[model samples]
Every structure is written in structure tokens, then in C-alpha cells.
Target: MELVFKTEDAISKLLTIKIEYFDSLQIYLLNDLWVHEMEGDFFLKEVESFKPILKRQLKYGLNPEEYINKVCKRIKEKLEFLEEHKVGSIEFLQFYCKQIKPITEITTFPSLGTDFYDEFKTSLKECKTDETDLYKFLVRFAEGNFNYTKYHEFSIGCLSYVIWNYYCALTELYRFVSTLQENAPFVDFSNLDIEDNKKCTEHLKTDIKVHFNQDKISVAHLFLFLLKEKHIVFDCKDERNNELQLKRFIEAHLTYLNINGDRVPIRSFNREFSEARASTKVQKHKQFINKFIYGLEQYRDSLKD
Candidate 1:
């Protein structure tokens, strides 16, 4: 007797596993969000949850062939379900993968594709040891209390977008490193304990923390790393911007109400948020809030100097 698996079925299965992987990441983020609210330890809370799952997955012993087969099967099922619904699972997956569209459908920054390589080269050329340069901030970010594993999840979330929206060319990632090497000594990322790093390998987790926080890093440096390695752009703003904008608007509105003696009794802030969210022109309202708050902040800052 002979055993054989159909390739299409294999792909579907893999995608299903990938979807599950994404779901696990979502759960992690949700937990982190809860922790953030409670001012709790994010990494410790996650490890408390992760160890049990890891034990269960490892119970059957190392079976790469079986594991791979199972993953492929799951992915295929998901794709089929999407196909039946007349939605490109690929397209839907792309949107979901990027943290942006899932949160709000406001803007679509075109995936950099190969142009990212050019931007990276240009950025690296302009890199200097500036304390405030965005690239420096990124390096500092890498070295800071970023929780690389969570950062990895964030990266994966971004990658889902990259795979779904941009060209699914994996080679572009490796090529990015070659480009970086052209300049100077870049981080030896191979030492990093990313998803596939073997057990007992010397991981870069501690070192990443130590170096990144020591000095302000360059945004250009960070951009190159993300673009080449992670396929994400830091300044390709989306969800974070939206949130900031909404926050600004609400603060400004409160200030105005206080000044005008409008007699609008301060009610539940949550209720107001709900109402604003329910509005048809939510984006416009959000923008209005953002602008007012930003302008007010700027005006205040200006007064000092």
C-alpha cells in the first residue's frame, strides 16, 4: 500500500492551521489588552497561559510530518469555506492579518512591494546617530521593554497583512538583509530566538533588550529591519493614528463644553463614546476631535517657548 496527499488539500489544511495560529495570537493580544487595563505583567500572564498549551501539543512527541499534514488540512478547509461564500480567503485573510483594516476600514497604505527595498536603501543612507530620529526610536523600541514575543505576535499580525495584501514573495525578505549588509554591521538577527529557532540555541532576547534601550535608534534602521525582515513599515500609519485622533477629539470637546457654559451635563464618558461610534460619520467626527486636540496641544506648547 502507498500513502499520498493531494497538494490542494495539503494547502487548505496548512491555511487552517495558520488561521488557528492567528486566532491564538488574537487571544494573546486580548489578554494583553486586559492586562494593560489592569496594569499587570503582560509576559508573565501569557506564560501562565502558554505552558499548558505547549505541554499538550508536545504530548504526542515530535512528528513533523503529521503536524505539517494537520496544519495543511486546516488551512485548506478555511479556504474552501471562503470560496463557497464567494470571498477570496486570501483577500479576507489579508485584511484580517493587518491590524489596521480589522480595527477600522479608514485607510489602505499600499503594500510597499519592492519599492520598500528602495525606501530602505534611501533610509539607511540618511541614518545618523540622532537622538530623535524615528529609526533610532525603533532600535530603542527593539531594545526597550517591548516583550519580543508579543512584538513577534504584532509582527505576525502585520505579516498576515503583508502576505494577503502584498506580493507573497518570501525571497524579498532575504534580499533585504543583503541590502543592509551593504552598508555596515547590522544586527545579527540570525541569533534572535524567533519562531523557528531551535531548542537550546543562544537566543538574542536579552541582548535585544540591552542594545536597543542603550541609545536612541534610528527610524530608518528600524524601517529597514521591519521592511526586510518583517514586511511592515512603522510610519505607514493606521490603527494607532485612528485611536490618537479619536482621543484628541474627545479631549477638545470636553474643554470646549467647559468654556462655553453649554450646560451639557457630563454624563457617562462610555455612553458618549458609544454614541459617537454609532454615528454614520464616525471617521469625520474622529478627525475633528483629533485636530482640535492636536491644535490645542500645539498651542499650549507654543505658549511655553
Candidate 2:
């Protein structure tokens, strides 16, 4: 008898397992940081806890170079450990899964699809039965066949999907730490002249309000358009890229408004500027485009006078 399996069901189950594993791992790592007040998302909490330390070091005239190197070294050590024990072992997986809280929904399984499923299934069948308990468990769970020794032989197969999820989480954590290090010097705790800063802030706000502020055009979209039009350029030599600098400026202004009794969620920016610019090229925004062009022409006519 030929055996058939619903790949979607298997994939969905695996995806759920992966998500649960990652969620548990995040909580574990966060707890390791000894953070008491968990206010926001994982990344935000990480930044909140980490930023102050860097600031404090700089304020005290301590060399942050040694501290950053130590942190990176620790992260690298963890990465190496994770790499070595990612697969061919089920102890870590079992430990993490024990802390897994039930999730209400599983919406995203990035980079996992039909191709991944095919490769996973083929690898499972090829793995040796005595290689590890993980392989034995997977085979039994997937096929529901206890007589696997009589039915088939297994060899060491593809890296377990669960390990892939853990590796990705760790890798992102490393990148976030690296970014914080790179942007450390940009964090200013001293008082500086506010006149120029105020002008730049107001200019950005007015441009957004006048030209690009629409229900359909997000701040991210506007910034993206400006970037493409060469209205803004990222200076490679700067500690923070132009995008980060702009984001901080806009967010600071929003915070000031909020403090003055304006209720607003922080604006989010992303790389969807191309879509916004493309939308303007269509007939839907033709009138808006024409108005902008006419304004420019009027400015030129006034200059002629």
C-alpha cells in the first residue's frame, strides 16, 4: 500500500511548533537579562535596557570599546554553541518546549513552503533510525508507524526546522546588538544649540504636511520617495544613517506633541516609498501632481519678475 500524507497539515503543525519554540526562547532570553518591567515588544525591551548602559558608560568617560567587544564576544560564543548543538540532539528542544505557552493563532511561517516540505520529507526518510532520539520521534510522529525498523532505514537528514527557527532568532539578536554598537556614538546626552535643530524639524514637518500628507501616503512612504528623489541622502560616514536620524527626529516631535496632550500612536516608517511614488504616477493622483508642478512654474514666473 502506498502512503500519502497531507503536507499542509504537517507543515502547519511544524510551523506552530517552531513559533511556540521561538516565543518560549525569547521569554527565556529576556528573563536572562533580569528585566522586571516588561513594557513593550521584545526588541523594544532589549533596546530600552541596553541603551542606558551605553549612555551611562559614555557619560562616565569609560571606554565603551572594551564593553562592546566583551558583549560581542559573549554573543559569538552563544552563536557557536547554538551552531554545534542545533541538530542531532533533542535535549535543548525538549527543554525549550517545556516552557512553550499555547498560542491562539499561527499566522506566519516565513520561508517555509512546498519546496521546504518536500525537502524535509525526503530528509526524514533518509535519516538513520539509531542516529538520535529526535529522528526516531519525528519518524514516529510523522508516519504513525512504530515498526519503522522493519519498514525503512533512516540516515542523518536535514537540519531540524526547530533549530533553524532558534538560529534565526539568535542571528537577529546579534544583528540588533551590532546595530546598537554602531549607533552608540550618535546618542547625545549633552545640551547643544537648538536653533538649527528646530528649523530642520519644522522644515521636515511642513514638507510632509504640505506635499505628501494624505491618508494613503504614510510617513515611511514619503521618506522613501524623498530618498529616491535624492531629496535626502544617507551619509555613510555618519554614525546613524539618514533614515535612522529622520525616524528619531519625527518620533521625538511626536512625543513632544503627546506630552502636550495630543493622543497619537507613534508613526511607523518602512520601505514602501516606491509603491507610494508609483501610485502618484497613475491618473488617480494626476490632479495632485499637476498642482505641485503648477506651483513650481508659478515660483519660476515670480523669479522672472
Per-prediction RMSD in angstroms? Answer: 22.3, 19.5
- Model 2, 259-299: lDDT tens digits are 23444433332212223446655553455556667978999
| TM-score per candidate, chains pooled | 0.20, 0.33
Candidate 2, residue 274: the lDDT equals: 25
Q: Worst 10-residue stretch by lDDT in candidate 2?
A: 150-159
lDDT of each: 0.31, 0.38
Q: Any idea how many clashes model 1 has?
A: 23
**lDDT value, residue 269 of candidate 2:** 24
State the local distance difference test value for candidate 1: 0.31
Candidate 2 differs from the real structure by a C-alpha RMSD in angstroms, to one decimal, of 19.5
